[model samples]
Target: MKAEISQAEKAENLSMTNWFSLLGLAVAVLLSSLNISIVNVALPRLASSFSVPMSEVQWLVVVYLLAMTCFMPIAGIWGDRFGRKRLFLFGIGLFFCGLIACIVSESLTQLIAARLVQGIGAAIFISLAMTFVSDFIPATKTGTAMGILGTTSAIGTALGPVLGGYLISHFDWHALFYVSVPFCIFALLLLARQLPDNAPVPFKLVKSGRFLAQFSENPALAGSLTANVCVSAIIMSTMVVSPFYFTDGLQLSPAQIGAILSVGPIVSALTGAPAGKLTDHLGSGTVVRVSLWIMLLGCLLISASAFWTSVPVYLFALILVTAGYAMFQAANNTAVMTEVKEGQKGVTSALLHFSRNLGLMAGASVMGWLYLFTSTFFPATQNQPATAFGVTFLISAILVGLAQVMVSLRKGR
Candidate 1:
């Protein structure tokens, strides 16, 4: 009786610690995600203040994304060698310093440089955050934990524009950077207190190579990563193209376009927890397959909306795509992380993020170019933008279809 009671108490204590750790991790996720989105609203203001063209100010956003992508893999390797908690603390501190630099910057060059520093710090924590679920959460609840992270991320994405607008309106553009400082401090303190330190591993470049080589041996990991890249590309493409489509094709005002665009992140936030529950009950593989089908269907609907010029159809399709993405993200992360070899969790997580950022960069450039190229071929008398939108989404659907086929073939084999 005494032993049973002791075991029960230990379990409860561990559970409490896990929840606290998760809270810290969630805050980190929110901070990183908010930064990704919050800066866009300030770009015009920044350009005016710096006396530069929009093209020059745009580098502030692009440089951050580029730095995050470039640094993530290295950060992962360092996390494993030096201890993730220590590295994560360093990352938060670096991010705080970057924010201070951004607030005090006198030139566009200085602000862009500060953003690069911030991105590197964001990369470190974002890559390590998923690994924490594997470390601290019970296996059965992994999906739910991932879902919570997804929800936090979606909330940050959804809130960034609104919050940035409010801050810029009431205060100054610098307030956009200032808002995150308190949250970063809180995350640092909570994580420092709650997370247990892991034993440091010997650093090796060969280990990263060996981990990459596992893609050939581990079909599940390969398929999940491939799907991640494709889905991320498709999602980013929608974000990049949809506003132009709404304006040129549907003839909507900027306010209406903003309202419509907001639906995707809102739906993603709303669906994240439920999707995670579904993943737990249905299994990650099953949830992934279903989510892909949903996304494909949504893409088709989006294509149809281009032809019909129906706002309702577009809204419904956005909900489906975003909700499906939320589901896929939770299940896919669970699947990929589940297959990580011992001692490689940090690198594996980093690779997952790298694939996503790569996809986003590709989608922004390639998809926009594709839309422009296709638009030129259409007659001016026709709804050229709408036709281009339709064709672009049809191609996106094909990509999603290809991913589903790949996953199916791998499962069959």
Candidate 2:
């Protein structure tokens, strides 16, 4: 047990790395990001193929988030108890299974179910990967390494729409799921070579549970967690309705919407590293405060654009919104990690992940409900859909703005 505890604290004496570990970490991060946006472009195709309403098609997206959210809290604890490497490998295996299942899925139900499984895999890996990085990398090098990871994840999210669009147009949507298999296998193999089993952490299940229950004991944890949920909810709420607004309202094609949606992630990926450095220099608090304002401003910009009937204005607003979100996410993650005890890091990370998932679920559900309400009352033809979506964004902006205020409240003795 003593040996196990020491192993769990492996990074206590860890030195900075070269590039191999960095590359491996990037792969893991990208996989997580891919899960988030990979299905966006496929949504239209999936909806058409499954003969489902656009609103119902969102279940495929939200179900995955629900699974990820529910499982995120425990993933970190499992990492500590079972060894982070073990958890990571298991996650990769699960991801591969999910990919295979997706490729073989025949119905909307099956596809959504498979995505939930994929979300579980992502929840496991993402939480553990963050913990592993903090454990094995030197503190001085952490920001840079994390920057790489963040940027990679953003890039994956950005690329997914364009890549998924191409794949769906040329091949079939199944190809999207199948294509990930090789990468998952490659990632698993490389991870095995690069990561050691090490020793397990002392597993006092009761103690761990008790610790988890005390999540509210840390004010920063609570605040950061709330902030995470709000930000993710706002972002996902926009995502849920954005495609429809672009394609139906603006009379664009799936390819065109894909191209537009693609811009945000690309900007995020390109800007994330510098944003990280900026966070390191300016402090997480400063970054978080600024990002929140920027995001809120973007929301207002979009709201105004909705009223003005300007597509270009909307696109410009979306770019700012995405950039601001990326900045906040990077900074908020760093702050959350710093807020908890070393032993509680995994649980905290998991909590943050959980919050994001829950936020996505909440945001998407609210948007869907609002869309229905608006469509029935205002009719589908004009910009009623946009108005419905715009209202959801306004609400999300308020929630996120409130969260930012909470983050601003400093904890004291």
Candidate 3:
């Protein structure tokens, strides 16, 4: 009875700390997400300032993604080797440092370099944020915690363009970089105060060549990771092409494009809490099954809607797609981390991150190439880009559908 009472007190303290940690991590994830979309609005300004070609200026975004992509897997190991808190603090510090450098950058090269630094920090912070939740929160509450994190990310992605537009109009484009600094500083402070400095648990490093195969030794982990990568690929395929569909094909203005794109993230943010509750009640399996079906349906709807020239129809299609992705992502992430062994949390989380980013990179590169192919081979048709995008979505859907099969085939824990 005395031991039972002690365990209950410990549980209560952990619950409070978990909530605080979630708040801190969400802010960190939000700032990182903000940097991704905010700069899209500022690209033209950046181009004019440096007198660079649009293609050259695009590197500012591309480089950041590539840097993050390359660095993300490494972050997982760092979290496992160092404590999650130490790595978390370091990552946030690096993000702000990079932001500061970006604000003062004079040349395009300098800006790209600084953004790469920011990407490295972002990769570290994001992976650790997920792993940290698994550390502090109980298994049952994982979905809810992830839901909050997902919502914060959605808010950042949605608000980034609107905020960037305002700042670029009244202030120099550089202010966009400076804007995120204070929020990150606060996140770092909160994390330090609230997060426990639990010592790192040691483990043998898994090689990239052996990473997937060794991890696949656990059927559940393999299934979860596979599903995550497939869903991520589908989401990114639509996102990468949507701007062209809106601006070039539909002839919307930049602000209108921002508004249209904003709808998905807005709905995502709104639905996050509910999705969390569902995950908590239904478990990650049910959540993923339902979410994937929604995503699959949305993909088909949007692909068909792309044939039409109506703005409202397109926006509605996008909202459905985004909502599906939002729910799918939160549930999928919760599922992925929970399937791993407790001591393997960092590596498992890292492998999952690596897989997702790897999927995005693969999707973006392959889908972009397909778009270019269509533009060259089918240039006479006005619907060529949509056709190309639809084809990509169909492939993505099939992949995700296969993932569903794997999930169904997966046995008990």
Candidate 4:
């Protein structure tokens, strides 16, 4: 009788924790995605405000990811040592500080530094958000949780451009940064209240040290890492190039561009659960490969659009990319969580996020460099079109091809 009563009590407590954690995490994830989307939309305006070329201004995006990537692994490990809740709060606080710094900055240098701080904080909370989901939910339900998270990501992504456009048009570019601050504070307070308050658990360093070592033995980890980096590179490259292309090549307004761009993420956010279920049925390796193929087609379409100067084709291409992203996220996260060992959930989550942020940094930096190089080396081409951008997409397609191969080899143990 006592055993039955204790089990019921434990179950009830876990259920409460799950609801609280999921609610807080969903809000946090949404806010982050929304801010990112708005930032992407406001990039050109930011460049105009600072009187800098897109090349220099793009560093605002690149530096943020670089800082986040650098911080992810360490944040992961530290969250394990200090308590995930504490780490989560710190990430929020740091990000809020960066936001304040950005608003007041008079120079580009100051803004970049502030963005770096923001990225580091973002890395901490984003990494721990996954850990919280994995810790709270059962393995069988992880796909659902990730799907919900992915959906949250999609919602923010979809809404960002439209909302951001409205803000930039009516208010100003600064409004984009301003909107996220209060929401982030509220989410922080709520998250702190909802998350588990247990003391940090200690684990042996030697056992924890094996994350990379063990990574080699797991095909899922290896393939997922490769896929994440490549796929994200393709996505980020499109983000950097497309806005410029839309305004310059296509001559679209921010409002019009946001409307067009919103389609992909809307498609993605809607398809998340279905994709999760498909992954549950078909397996991660299969789903990942298939999604990459779809993304490949999208990449090819966008590259072709640049060469041919086809506006319709470029818009169509975004749909494919969004669909692939939605499917890939739902399946990939589930595969990763399944592969992680008994301990080190936080670390594993960090590593996955590390791979992702690295991709974001690489995508923005490499593509931005290519853009600047084209402008510098082929001054005549600048008058022509997104001439260098076409070449970048072709390179990204090959990287996607390589990622497809990695996941293909992921078979039975």
Candidate 5:
């Protein structure tokens, strides 16, 4: 583990020629990013395909997230135990295999199972993609290189909706799965050609285990983790609900919903880099508090749109949520790691990743439950789906407020 971070420090001293491998790494990151968001556009279509209710079909999202959350720490351990090339290739194979399964699935249960496989693959890749890429670049250039890759994530987030929208609009949902094939093949070929034979970090899990002691004792770390979970939960819950809300409540087409929803990621992409820098200057705690306020406001705006069904209000709300999440993540992640001792960095990072994925699973699962329950209670919510979704968002906003208070009360950083 020390060897792995030491590499990041030494990256600045490497020859420029070593950067050639970054192309392959960037492709991997782009693929991961696109896969993450593209699936959102398919939720409504999946419900139709499986002949399931909006909430029931959400198992596709929830299952995948839970699988990813479960696999993250294991992936990190295995990557160290095995070689990066071998581990990453295995992950790719698993992902494509899962995609194949998804394309061929006959029922919602089968699709959810396939998605679980895909999520495992995603866990492996996402766990190592940035670190793997940094292995080939100079330490001095690592930050900029990582930031460039981060931008690709934003681009992918923006593209997922629009691309998924187009594919589902013109062809079948299968087209969306097909889209990943070229990138996967390209990444596979590139990694095979470019990566080194020897492992960069000494394979170890015991180091990651040490953080459990500190994490349990550290109030600040615990608070940061909780805040991140809540924030991520809110963000993902909105994603799960938006497609249904727009389609059922607003009577919009998949294409229209995709186009409208793309606006948030676009704003997030634009603000994300600057936000990281701002976190450095203002301090993570301060920025995080401000971000929670912005997101709370955003959630309220979207909640209001249930009554009005105003596109303008929705977009405005989306901008706040997207931008707030972008800023919040940068600061929150920085805060978590900065608070940890050097020896505990690996565990802290793993815990942070786990918390983030857990948040995704919780957000989707919880909001899905909330929406279904609200619909059952207020039967009118069946016809006006937005009302049910609006209630969910309001509940999420309350959680965020609670998160802010938690952050405020934390005794350390």
Candidate 6:
């Protein structure tokens, strides 16, 4: 009886600690994602305040992205070699300081520099957040934990524009930075108190080489990573091209276009937790296959909308695509992290996010250019915008189809 009771009590304690730790991690994830979008809304005000051109003010966003991407691999290696908990705390603290610096900055240069600091901090924590779920949560519950984190990320992303707009309107641009301070403090306290530190692994250059060799040898890992890149590019392409389509092809107002565009993120947020659950129940491979099919269908529908020119069809297609992407994200992330060799989760997780960033860059540049090139082939008729939109999505569908083929071939092997 004593042994049984002791075991039960210990389990309860662990459960409690897990709960608190997850909360801290969730808040950290939210902060990281929120900052990415929140800063965009403040660009005009920043330009005016700093007396700089919009192009110059844009560097604030660019610098942060660059810093995050460049430092991610290093952060991951450090997290594994040092300790994830310690690094995560350090990241949170650094981000907090960056926020303070942003609020106090008297010039655009100072603000941009501060954002760089925040970006590096974000790279550290965001890279490690998924690894924490893998390490601390039971394997049986990994899907559910991943889903919760996914939901939190979506919420943060969805909330950023709305929250930033509200804060900026009511107070000032500085309010955007101020709003996160309390949440950051709360996350730091909770994580410091509840999260357990993992033992540090020794870092060696040879081990990294072996990890790379292992990655190349593992079809699932390589396939999943490639799929992530393709999916991110597809999503970013839609974001970059959709507004023009809504305004020119659909003849919609800004408000209507915003409403339509917001649906994608909203659907993503709603789908994340359910998708995670599905991933758990159905297995990552199965879920990923289904998600790719759903996305492919969405792309076809979007292409059809060019002729249909129906707002409802466009919106439905957007929702389908976004939801499919969210599901794929959860399942794919789980698949990749599950495949990581012990003591290498940090680097693997970082690589996953880094691939995503690369995809976003490709989508913004290459895919956007593709749209422009395709649009030029169409004569300047009233339907020109629709035609370009259709062609772009058709190409996107082909890409997704190729990804599906790659995944299938890997599975067959």
C-alpha TM-scores of all predictions: 0.87, 0.90, 0.86, 0.90, 0.84, 0.85
lDDT of each: 0.80, 0.74, 0.73, 0.78, 0.74, 0.77
Native-to-model Cα distance after best TM-score fit, residue 311 in candidate 2, in Å: 2.4
Report the lDDT tens digits of candidate 1 across residue range 255-287: 455456667778998999888888889998899
| Ranking, TM-score, top scorer first | 4, 2, 1, 3, 6, 5
Q: Which has the better lDDT: candidate 3, or candidate 5? A: 5
lDDT of 3 by residue, 214-247 (tens): 4557677677777777766665555455655554
Which regions of candidate 3 deviate over 4 angstroms?
A: 1-15, 41-58, 165-172, 204-214, 380-396, 409-413
Angstrom error of the Cα, residue 35, model 6: value is 2.3
Model 2 superposed RMSD (Cα):
5.2
**TM-score winner, 3 or 4:** 4
Best by lDDT: 1
Residue-level lDDT tens digits of model 2 in 318-372: 8788788788878888776654555566676677678877887876677656656
Over the stretch 1-413, how does candidate 6's per-residue lDDT look in tens digits?
Answer: 99999999999999988988988888998887677656554555566777886457667666766777777777777888888899989988988888899899877788889999988888888888888888789887887788778777767766665566556556767777887888899999999998888888766732562436646667667777778888877876665566556656766644444456567767888998899889989998899899999999999998998878877887799888888888988888887777677677888888787777667656655675676677789898878888898999998898788779767866886
lDDT of 5 by residue, 338-371 (tens): 5444334334555666777788788777876787
Q: What is the lDDT of residue 377 in candidate 3?
A: 60
Q: Report how far residue 154 has shifted in candidate 5, in Å.
A: 3.1
Off by over 4 Å in 6: 1-3, 39-62, 104-112, 164-176, 204-211, 243-258, 303-309, 368-390
Candidate 4 per-residue lDDT over residues 1-413, each given as its tens digit: 99999999999987987887887888788776675666676678778888988878888888888887888888877787778899898898898888888777778899889888888888889887888886778887788788888888888878888787778778756566787777788888898888876466566742563457647656567777788988887777766667776777667788887787787778888987788778877886678778988999988888898888877887789889878977888889888887675457777888888888788778777876775576455455434446766777778789889888777766534
Candidate 5 ranges beyond 4 A from true positions? 1-26, 80-86, 130-150, 191-211, 338-346, 379-383, 409-413
- Count residue pairs with overlapping backbones in model 6: 0
- Highest TM-score: give the candidate number: 4
The CA lDDT at 295 in model 4 is 92
After superposition on all CA atoms, what RMSD does each candidate show versus the true structure? Answer: 3.2, 5.2, 3.7, 2.9, 5.3, 3.5
Between candidates 4 and 5, the lDDT winner: 4
Which sections of candidate 1 miss by over 4 Å?
Answer: 1-7, 40-58, 105-108, 164-173, 203-211, 244-257, 372-385
Q: Candidate 4, 37: how far from true, in Å?
A: 2.7
